[model samples]
Target: MKIKNQIKLSILTMPENVPLARVTVAAFASQLEFNLDELEDIKVAVSEAVTNCLVHGYSNDRNRTVNIVCSIYDNTLEIIVEDEGVGITDVSKALQPAFSTDPERMGLGFTFMQSFMDNLEVRSEISKGTRVTMTKRPQQDLAAAASEEN
Candidate 1:
């Protein structure tokens, strides 16, 4: 798939940055003419992705850095969240509902990402890092609306 445009941001792993990540992605996604609910879904998915990076990837270190990349294509928006911290040993197990390495977590991050986006891909290696890539293709009506407004 060819990318029409892209933006990349790197921020500290502070909990506060989660909202920043969400809003930025939502703003970029707004170009696709998503409705309020669709925008909210994108924000929630971004929040989960960044939160997972902070909570599990960096273990709340706050000193680490998290990178986010947003790409725009013809009718799809792709977002990637990455962290260089302790990585997951079992990607499959982590994707399971209600499975979390930390007992305090509900382990629904991946599930939410999957539910909100059309496609989700996770890559990780022990002690290396983890990257989450998500793609959302606007519905036909939404795409038509965007073009009409243009």
Candidate 2:
């Protein structure tokens, strides 16, 4: 699917901005044919990714920044969240279930993103940063939808 629209936002690494990221993404995704459940899933996935940036990436350092990019493509929506904090050393291990750098955390961020979105890709460099790209495709029939709209 071709991209129809996109938005980019940069916010301080604050816990309060997590909701802002989720709501902004969900609002942008609403332009597509996603159902309420699908919108909720997108929001959850965005929340997890952003929270990881604040908690794990920046270590609760509110002075840091989080960048979020959301793109709408016909029936699909892509969301990218990034942070310029200490990057993950083991991307493969991080993707595993219940694996967290912080012992106090459950480390289910990647799991939630995987379960809620259709595609999840992560790239990180030590002492550099981490970028998480997630894509969601609606379950509705695009052909049927087009015919109905016409």
Candidate 3:
């Protein structure tokens, strides 16, 4: 499929980033034939990620900006959430459901992303920042593919 347009939005490391995440995700989902389930999944997953960056990554420090870049290429939608804060020291245990640095956090953001999107990738450095990237593609049209192949 031909890519129509790809959009990007940058947000500061503030609680407001949560709403921005929601809006940006919805805009991308609007381009496809997503059902309620798909839409909700995307929203929840993205919200959790953005919240993680704003809260944990920046430690609620709104002075820093969390760079969120999204691109719709080919049949795939890619989202990257980045924060210039303390990077994740442990990757394996971080994705667990109960793993969290804060008492109030459930530490399920990455897990939700795995459940919602087709692909989830996380990268970070101790002093650099954390970047969470996710990619979801439009459901494959088997009928169209078959027709084209024939």
- Highest lDDT against the true fold, candidate: 2
What overall lDDT goes with each candidate model? 0.91, 0.91, 0.79
Tell me the alpha-carbon RMSD of every candidate. 3.7, 3.2, 2.7
- Report the C-alpha lDDT of model 2 over 1-150, residue by residue, as the tens digit: 687899999999889988988999999888888899989999999999999999988989999999999998766789999999899999999999999978988989899999999999999998999999999877785568778999
Residue 99 local lDDT, model 1? 94
Q: After superposition, how far is residue 70 of candidate 1 from its true place, in Å?
A: 0.2
Model 2 gets an lDDT of: 0.91
lDDT of 1 at 111: 96
Candidate 1 structure quality by residue, lDDT tens digits, 7-109: 9999999998889889999999998867788899999999999999898888889899999999998778999999988899999999999999888889898
Local lDDT at 6 for model 3:
68
Model 2: pairs clashing at backbone N, Cα or C within 3 Å: none
In angstroms, give how far residue 111 of model 3 lies from its true place.
0.9
Each candidate's TM vs. the true structure? 0.91, 0.91, 0.86
lDDT of 3 at 101: 81
In Å, residue 20's CA in model 1 sits off its true spot by 0.9
